[model samples]
Target: MTLLRDLPLSALRALAAAARTGGLTRAAEELGVTPGAVGHQLRQLEDRLGVKLVRREGNGIVLTRIAEAALPDIDRGFDALASGLRRLRFERRADTFTIAADPSFSSLWLAPRLGNVRAALGKLDVRIVVSIALDSMLEEGIDLAISYRYSSARDLASADLFTERVIPACAPTLIRNRSDRDGVEMLDRLPLLHIDQTMGDDVYPTWANWFTAAGRKRKNIDHGPRFPLTVLAAQAAVSGMGALLASELVLRQHLDSGQLVEIARDVPALTIKRRLVWPVDGPKARRASAVAMALAAVARAEADGLRSAVS
Candidate 1:
């Protein structure tokens, strides 16, 4: 950019605000300066540019034809400059917290609870990056992360938000025909829904694990349609596709909305832990601490209500 340090930034700001507000007093209110100061800046700007910029009109002031022609560009330039400065300020400080999480968790759980977090944090800005690729948390400058698997990074701080019990879930209509008490036994007979995303990771406990936990011996545990995401798998199960082993905490909304129901509430629930992770050694780690506190508040507020809903 060409150096225009000779043009006073304060004068340009006053001119743009006056143009936008259509009056000196309103511009002064926005700029936190007096109308006389604004008028003086406008005069100085006009003198520097060697042009008449404003004229007295009745009891008010109006932009001259030359100033009117320049108003649009000046407004655009000053607005862009202010915006760039705001971004830089956010970047330098800890006002904005960047978060990363699994899409399913982000959509089903964390996104819904962000309102509470926002309320707790008050003035903090949150940027959410949803992806299954969470190993890059440190590289991405993620202040906080919600992940299905536990973190093994020695340099990162981790907190267990909550553990979810996995249960057989399906559309209520799917099991409505079988009113018998041993409906969970039918889970083996139906086409079991398997989330294919966890096939490669092997960290998330799968259908086989759930069956073992439920004390059933099914050899064909891998026989089900595959989906790339858990959210998709849960939706498919809700559509009466097949029974899916889903998280009790994650499936609360589906259970509450009657989209899906657990096959056996008393049976042993498969347990899975969700965690919050962030680098231990970052300048913005303090903000991460604040976020963690907010998350804890959210968890405390929801834990009893969620667990009691079906316990």
Candidate 2:
């Protein structure tokens, strides 16, 4: 049997219209076509279906038995299609906002604070599109994007959301005695969980970079189980699999809950700036600006709290 999608939609519409209006002339008037076009469409429909759908009865037309049986379902399908299109139009209105972010940022940071965003926005519908690819922001309908790179797109407005410090952290049990050895020496001896550096930029820090930043150099910095995402490396650190060079912002909850502890405090930390980007002008620009302000406020408060805890 042929799929519904394989059937010609125009022919189906012609059949439905001809049956509804009870004549080729009236169907053509409804469809804005000549009566000859309507008749041709009906013939095409019949040929495709391999069945007679209508018959000439004097000056008017009569639906065949099969056509009468199928007309009601076809009419209902068209009604449903119209309703779906209406819903899409309603959702595309300015009241709804879309934010795109990488998976690590979305899950570890932004997802937790979405409630505060909702409370600030009141009735607006907020949508999140999780992705590492910032290029999607250029597509229509995406109102905002949170990413590590500062986009140079002329049509976009961008600002720093926060600069997160990367510190060495591990499960509390991983370090038995802190005072016996040098901090850099101790960290060098521990298994270090590595995040796959797929960003193809120096923005993402590695164990080798961390060691260098700490005023020391170590060999075999690449040894360890590798994870594609920061959150997974963090979990590995929590499980005492190894020490993780983690973003202080993403690891805030884990540190607070005692799942992980900051190590090598005397060493320099790596900083990565997270940016918020949105269209400079659009139907949703005003609302996107409102959301950007709200997000920055929440991020600042959280950063302050993190600093206080560390202090």
Backbone clashes, each candidate: 1, 0
Q: What lDDT does each candidate get?
A: 0.76, 0.81
Model 1, 1-311: lDDT tens digits are 24385668999888878877878998999999999999999999887789998877766678889988988888888788878987776575466677877667777778787887775555777778764345676665677877766767787787888777877888887775544324567775777888765411356778877777677788677988888777888889888898887677667789899898888555677777777777787877766777777886688768788679979
**Which RMSD does model 1 reach against the true structure?**
14.6
TM-score of 2: 0.65
Could you say which candidate leads in lDDT? 2
Candidate 2 per-residue C-alpha lDDT over 1-311 given as tens digits, one digit per residue, 9 for 90 to 100 = 45676767888888988888889999999999999999998898888779999999998898999999998889999999988987786567557677887667888778888887776566777778764455556553678888777777788887879988988888988877775122666786888898875442236777888888777877788888998878888888999998899788778889999999888877778988888888888777767777888899998998799789999
Lowest summed lDDT across 10 adjacent residues in model 1 is found at 176-185
Q: Which of the numbered candidates is closest to the native, going by highest TM-score?
A: 2
